[model samples]
Target: MLLSIRPSLFAILLPLLLSRHLPTAASRPAPPSDTWRSSDRFMDAERGTHVAGLSDLKRYFSRFGYLPEPDPDANPTDAFDDRLETAVSLYQTRLGLRVTGKLDAATLAEITTPRCGVPDNATLAPSRAHSVGRFAFFPGEPRWARSGPIVLTYAVSPTATIHYLPRGTVEAVFDLAFARWAQAIPVQFTKTANYESADVKIGFYSGDHGDGEPFDGVLGVLAHAFSPESGRLHLDAAETWAVDFRRERSAVAVDLESVATHEIGHVLGLAHSAVKNSVMYPSLSPRTKKADLRADDVEGVQALYGSNPDFSFSSLIESDTTDSGSAAARRGGGVRSSCMGFLLVLVLVIVI
Candidate 1:
């Protein structure tokens, strides 16, 4: 049956439904040797630190969304060295890194390479592929479905392993990621990690690392993940990953938590959503936050999972669109229907 509905609104209900893997943060060339030497005092930019001189450094990074502590550094940048005490204090607050401001293992990785970015997921080569048959989303919702899970017997790739952090913390991040997805849609799924089993495995990697994609340098790329196939996800070893937030910014803004959240969405069987209000939108609008999920993100996922027969008026959030753009294109005739939704107000996530 041929059918189509405005996924923008649907995104609110099932945030992961037909989501898009968005391209975020423009690729940047290697930074000059003196990236650390320059400093304008992050104080004016935002109220990140209470200290006037050094504490401001930590506050600045916090505002930028880099975890408070990063990996320790070996060769501290000259500017940071000049402000050594202050830099070290700032370093300790953010990343668990050495706090020396010199590039260490984790700190060097983040400084010389990107810690987080979008993933270059594999394409579902349509020309020659086997269909597992058809599974339909609930009636009136064609864009969502629960793709039955498949377990990997192992060795799908000779060289494959999870990247970044201790197993426990990684698992925690992954678990929270799923919970966020559940908030968007009620797939109500569960997971268990088995480094020993063929089903799901978790660990670290580098650019062109495992998959075809390769990291260029510090800000060139972040990381990538695959669909929930074999429960596989790839992280760029180049990333200076830390539970603590810290960033290696280039031309554009890239947040670790934000990109991680998006990649996890892909692992849950969602594609890209065009609606700007949706977290599934490929590029993160500077206006959006690293932690908050959008209505479209929530709705798109709901499409995959069946909705409760018992409903509530609170589920609706009105889109602020008028008779314009794609909204008009889908309406073949003049037949008008003001979509029943909640008027979005006082929120960071956009809803269309």
Candidate 2:
């Protein structure tokens, strides 16, 4: 049976069909790096209980610096021993979760969430404690040591690039991400064409691309950056990185700007923040965007690099409120428009 469709109806139907078939993050199978997802099987597990896959959970703890790396030669045991319990307690404490020393649902959920590749507690010193405040720094409190006005050059890797997003789009996102930090601190970031010589080098990489810390495909580890003068920022190319949530309607699509901003914080020497609202916070959920720096982030950065003369907490708060309100309005309008279009398409389909 052949049904004739008018040009107007065809236009609407064609877009819907194309969109439906478009490859999305949700459509893609879970990446191998998501092995932590299996940690849920050990939910509510405490010390003295031996679960089959508890060794994998121990690897997760070791990966994030909660527990020391196990000996490669020795076989890893699945026992939920005292060491594992202590590691779980430390992890919870670092993330501001309840320090129960058990694999509670909340702890498991956090374990499974996508987070930065950088260790939460990297070479911790006795003086620098996570309990001190929401913000933290690398062991030595690394900062770009410059006498005069701190100006750092950053460049994206020409060779290691993502095919999905345009080079210009990626560059612009990083530019804005750098600008956000500039607004808060005295440091100025300048984009450079010289990838090798640039103070900060950014790249999109797949599994095991040097730097010791390999990219764990997809949501496991979205990105990681080095502290201070190290000047390295790498994003996992396997991730469904999205610049706009509206256009890229993937269930697991991660906001590129948000990740970029957070990694830039690492490059600036701020470690994972306990404050969930701060960009430096370790875990970021899929389909969620948070680029703006909160008070904790600002204070942390300012401590390292003195505040920008024009910057003020009140001004930032006002700007954030205005931006949030506008974004909410846009989302509301988009929903209404989409509903109207869907209803119109339904009516046309019925008539045809």
TM-score of each model, paired residue for residue: 0.40, 0.76
List per-prediction Cα lDDT, in the order shown: 0.38, 0.72
Off by over 4 Å in 1: 1-165, 189-191, 196-202, 228-230, 242-255, 284-289, 308-352
Clashes of each: 73, 0
Q: What local lDDT does model 2 show for residue 49?
A: 18
By summed lDDT, the worst window of 10 consecutive residues in model 2 runs over: 42-51
| Per-residue lDDT of candidate 1, residues 1-352 (tens digit) | 1012232433232222212122222332222232222233211112211222223333334323332333356322213334444544344333333555432233322222223333211121112122321111112332323356322332122234333344555555656665666554545535544355543343345434455545433333455555554355555443334444223222233444556677666555555443433455444322123444555555545445544344332543443233335333422222112111111211212422
Off-target runs (Cα >4 Å) in candidate 2 are: 1-52, 122-132, 315-352
**Residue 163 miss distance in model 2 (angstroms):** 0.3
